[model samples]
Target: MAGYLTTHVLDTARGCPAQGIQIALYRVSGNSHKKIATAETNADGRTDAPILPEGKFAVGTYELIFFCGDYLRATGQTADDPLFLDQVPIRFGVSDGAAHYHVPLLLSPYGYSTYRGS
Candidate 1:
């Protein structure tokens, strides 16, 4: 199968899907990053489409920046000027170009966790 990338976000503290969170995908090379795609999470906490679709797939280092500040504030979770968990960046490498990648985030106002999902 052709490769692609998908993501999901959940507000662990609120026990609900993280909606309206902005997500940016970037191709990383050493110190350089080139943004390739952007998406917003729906009510289901998933992008309407794969963040990185098959035609645009590549094998290399990549970074996903999840914009959580707005969601936190909108949901009354923000408490300070600088959020402890704002733009959470997860950098990972894709070793195979023909495999699907699912990255999921379990998030709270102060912290977050990510893992490679099915």
Candidate 2:
């Protein structure tokens, strides 16, 4: 079996999956950045398919930009106050292309966290 990239989002404040959140993946090389994929979170806060399919995995720096501010506004949250966390960018490296990368986000109105999962 080959490797692939996957992600999920949890809205900690709402205590549910963050559906409809937009995310973009970028391959970073020094001062340059190349966008590889774009996806939206499903009802379960996951994409319909892998962000990076098996054969596409590479050893390099990558970034996932989660559109947090837009998601909050769309979900009926007031934007009267400045959002502490807006677009959350999680940058990581893929050292082994043969290994599955499961990056998940636990998000809230004020903060967010991510980790490499199985």
Candidate 3:
């Protein structure tokens, strides 16, 4: 079976879900950017719902912007000089709606990593 767009964020430093993180979904609208949707991570470090409906997906470039600064601050994980990675945008293209796009984030106070997942 095919999958749809999904993501999970893990706070590697705290070894738990990166909750309360602000996330934005943007599509290249004209020569500028326009937000399609916005969501905050649930207790499980996942959006309450899919960023976009499964049936609405099409072949196009999209961006997932993860706001980690406030999340780090709220958790008291790091303060001044914290290596917060603001605007962690994962830009990707959807070739087919039939396939799923799982983009998970494994993050620390200093850095983060993301990849296409199943």
Please list all clashing residue pairs in model 2, or write none if there are none: none
- Give candidate 1 misplaced runs (Cα > 4 Å): none
Best by lDDT: 1
Off by over 4 Å in 2: none
Task: Find the 10 residues in a row with the least total lDDT in model 3.
Answer: 78-87
**lDDT tens readout by residue for model 1, 11-115:** 999999999999999999999999999999999999999999998998999999999999999999888898888899999999999999999889998889999
TM-score of each: 0.97, 0.94, 0.87
Clashes of each: 0, 0, 2
Better of 2 and 3 by lDDT: 2
Per-model lDDT: 0.94, 0.91, 0.81
Model 3 bad stretches (over 4 Å): 1-3, 29-31, 81-83
Assess candidate 2 and give its lDDT: 0.91
Q: What is the lDDT of candidate 1?
A: 0.94
Identify the leading candidate in terms of TM-score. 1
Residue range 1-118, candidate 2, lDDT tens digits: 7778999999988999999989999999998999999999999999999999888888899999998888888887657467777789999999988899999999987778899999
Candidate 3: tens digits of C-alpha lDDT, residues 1-118: 4436787799999999998888888887557777888888899999888777676666678888999988877787777764556668888888886787888889887789998888
lDDT of 1 at 118: 94
